[model samples]
Target: MTDSTSISLPADQRRREFIGGAKATFPLIVGAIPFGIIFGTLAEPSGLSAVGALAMSIIVFAGSSQFIVLGLLAAGAALPVIIATTFVVNLRHILYAANLVPKVRHLPQRWRILMAFGLTDETFAAVSSRYLQQEDIREAHWFYLGSFCAMYGNWVLCTAIGVALGEIFPDMTQWGLDFAMSVTFIGMVMPYLKNKPMWAAVIVAGAMAIATAALPHKLGLIIAALSGVAVGLSLQMLLTQTNTHSPAPDKEPQ
Candidate 1:
């Protein structure tokens, strides 16, 4: 009885963690539904077939890059321009990967690759929050897998729905549905602004984004992201040095 119980416990724990991760992502999934549908609605008009749009959602699976591709196609951009533009837009993923590497380094390469394919803004937010709370959870990767599957399934289903509805509505993209994603992003970001470095980074990024809004191919976003990262790193290093050099408080009387 003891041996059987021991053998079953880990599987049970993994299942629970997976379910918990999926549940945690419900709100973000809600926010992304309309955005996915909007992309679906825009796909045909942007010269992509329904199959192509769905394939992109399945293969590329990056919401921002998919949207940019559609826009570039609509603008009649060259194939290389579309590829380069999407590549630039997704450079932010490098930062995400860097932050996660330490935490996931022990996983097998196959697991890491699968997780990387599923890493997105929503899954990253959900997984990172959990990892922050409990860094050594043995089942954390299952949680990440759950979150990824939930978001992926939701996005694909929503896109299909939009593709079907496009024939009926034909103007669903203009329904102002994409705003939900902006609100969702704000919600995702607001929780991390608990320190000076974070606050400075966000402010600088926001300001740079606004000031450079006129840049072509959405290069302003990249500029804003880099500016914020630089400012944040500088402030963080300065604070670390200050702490290291500061005098220790005198011990109370021995």
Candidate 2:
């Protein structure tokens, strides 16, 4: 499946799709730069070496968890504690990655895994929408690569910027850039809120997150995400069954 997914796109089409997708999603990465910088700058204060700080961005390639890791390191948390927290902080990514796997299943395993790692909210939002709409796995792969490249580039570059000049900004909180993450999420989710099922999922997830806020180790986010996914899936399944079982209103009685 992996090889087949990538084989559909001709070489030239693949290149074109890659470039186009990259251009389309480039601005999103630009918007996310400040958040990356803020994370990097805070890394020094977290007591991690510059190498380790930068390495996390390159290898872990996740923004929120990297920041959390830095803080945990600064607090002198135990190694297991740090790993566990980072894993929890990143659990939402499983949702991102699982959704994308089918679209790129034709690619080879190595490519599939690499692409999976590159998956993030912004890139997945951009690439998956196009992939699902077109049903062109290779083009979707190209789009994913483009979106991922743009995001990956910005993250690496911005981390360097944050580390080198973060002190100049003084306070990331003061600049109001933190709102960008919230705004990014809104931009991604709002467009898909035209239906009741989706709206229900959003409401359920948010309510759960708020309700679980007091749970230890910031477990609320996990609960919220799980609740959101489960509610959405369960509701969808019930609706499917209801539709399948019920007679059509247009047909009426024979």
The best candidate by TM-score is: 1
Instruction: Compute each candidate's TM-score over C-alphas.
Output: 0.95, 0.88
Segments in model 2 whose C-alpha atoms lie over 4 Å from true places: 1-9, 250-254
lDDT of 1 by residue, 1-254 (tens): 36998999899989988998899888999999999999999999999999999999999899999999999999999999999989888888888999899888889999999999999999999998999998576679999999999999999998899899999999787889989999999988998999999999999999999999999878999999999999999999999999999999999997
- Please state the error at residue 198 of candidate 2 in Å: 0.9
The CA lDDT at 44 in model 2 is 78
Residue 231 in model 2: shift from native, Å? 1.4
lDDT tens readout by residue for model 2, 117-161: 887888878886787577546556777787888899899888888
- C-alpha RMSD (angstroms) for model 2: 4.5
Error of 2 at 186 (Å): 1.2
